[model samples]
Target: MSTTTIDRYRFETGIYRPPSEGGSASLLLRYTRNCPWNHCTFCSMYKTEKFQLRPVADIKSDIDAMAAVVDDLKAISMDIGQNGTITRDAAVSLIGKVPALNYHEGFAMLFHWLLSGARNAFLQDANSLIMKTGDLVDALHYLRSTFPSINRVTTYARSRTLVQKSPEELTAIRKAGLDRLHLGLETGDNELLKKIKKGVTAKGHIKGGKKAMVAGFQVSEYWMPGLGGREMTGVHAAHTARVLNEINPDYIRSRPFRTIPGTPLHAQVNRGEVQMLRPHEQLLELKNMIGALDVTSRVCFDHAMNNWRHPRSGLLFTHDYEGYKFPEEKQKVLELIEAGLNAGNPVSGAG
Candidate 1:
């Protein structure tokens, strides 16, 4: 039992909210705190405390409270041009009807309506996947039935949980309308896996990812560049490629490593126990990863967290490694970083 409470949440802009969902427009609901499994060495997102599941009733009340203020919300949003050409009267009219709806059911409904047709939702805390499947299924169904317009419901899941769920269990949840899962498959090298306390092995990742794909869900495996640093860059790229080949997931997402102030990696950095990769070294690591890739998955470096040369370019496994030379892409990214260094950009030495 843990006693920690957060009463308000705001949507973060410019972060990947999963496209199968409506991307960034969905409200990022924080139903828990930190992460249940927070041992990943490169992660600094949730360093505050051990994870604890929020009380369902408490979450419901927050929704109810927010719902009560829907009218004020619309007015403020509209006044600030947030609703995009929405008139004050229109915002008020919508607010007047908000009371007619149940808060829990309408949390997502109001979000979609407020966004003017954008449809997706993200459950927060680092690992909403830690919630009981039954609870999640009911919550997701309530949102779906109440709104009818929500086509995508997404959450973050650790690889360990994915492996633990049986095929039938995953299928049941998928059928219940959980469409996408964003996995933090930071590295696929077993040695690096142990080094980072990633909580699951390379084999576990491969199995879990394949299970998600087998269950007919859109799966995105997030890979972290420069995670192995200068020491294990070669093995990291090669083994990560091996795992991806085995899983053949729908999307291979790139998240370049950034050590924040309070994470375990920061301590390692200070102790000289871990070395951060140079920008060009990271680019080569990315190239080796692409070259060793055997699956035809679409890769994305779309997050602002990365310094990809063509951030939107997709690694088609065929054209990306063959028709186009990855070394050239690497060079372009390195050159861009050098220019930024000359200009004194804050993330100058990063890629």
Candidate 2:
């Protein structure tokens, strides 16, 4: 067998991606570095690191390098007479040729994405929409052309950035192959929005979300359930439902709040400035929000943080990604929340 070349297998990867994308075998691509906004009280991601937009040329190089690995892997498969299929044996053989791959952080993720049919891709670190429109469009074009198998490409975007982008520029990027956007709305109450330093108003969230939909991008908006603590929970629920109703996004996901130790919100909890909700209190807030929700969006409690369970079946609300189709299932979801409220088992944040 020929010596397996491994240099072209190198490509950069970022630390974060949404759970749905991560679980569904999406190819991870780093188009930008770190969070541009970095100031959210609840978020700890990219706090130490500064944001840098990768040049278009460098991004193209990453795409090429990833393609090079694919080509080399297929070559290995063909050399081993496996008819060009990416097999475990071929991967093992390549690793034998390049021992350093055993320590590569992204190698397993890349290989698994390939094996799972490479249909979805997620752009990483924080927000990709902060990139200059032309650069982003060019990168998306190059990526889509390079990996013809990828049908959906998504990235985290901030509502402020989306509101800042011109409609035409957003349209062009959507046409350039960026299919979906995952936005962190956090909370929609004006006061909570200020408290968290999310940098976007409730009005801005509605505008940005509606704009993304208008520009032909599927938008998944995430809101934190316990974001407002006890004092603000009622307003948080009411206003969040209000903003989401205004946007009517394609998907609405509940990411219940848990403060990471280093984040500012964690400090607030330590200081007794913010009172975290009790287990069942979280569901009561959800009941308020879900009851008021009036949208065509898919409502999801997809994250493990929504831990209140029904006494009979265990694990209330089926935190599955697709979740319940709303309007039709709204009553059912309210009933589940009621069940959780009545049940004696305390809410557990464990998966």
RMSD of each: 8.0, 1.6
Instruction: Report lDDT (Cα) of residue 96, candidate 2.
Output: 85
lDDT tens readout by residue for model 1, 1-351: 011111232121213244333433565555566678877777776565777787666555554454444545556667666774434454454435443322334344444545565466666666666777776666666556644656777778877888888888788788888887888888899999998899899999998999989998888888888888788999999999899889887778777786777778778877888788866566668778877776656676655555433323322112121122233454443444344334333231343
So what's the TM-score on candidate 1?
Answer: 0.73
lDDT of each: 0.65, 0.89
Estimate the overall C-alpha local distance difference test score of candidate 2. 0.89
The C-alpha local distance difference test score for the whole of candidate 1 amounts to 0.65
Candidate 1: residue pairs that collide: none
Report the poorest 10 consecutive residues by lDDT, candidate 2.
1-10
Per residue, candidate 2 scores C-alpha lDDT tens digits across 1-351 of 334445567788888998789853798899999989899998888999999999999889988988877887899999999999988988898888877778777788888889999899999989999999999999999999999999999999999999999999999999999999999998889999998999999999999999999999999999998889999999999999999999999999989889899899999999999999887888889899999999999999888787788888978888787899989999999999888989966575621
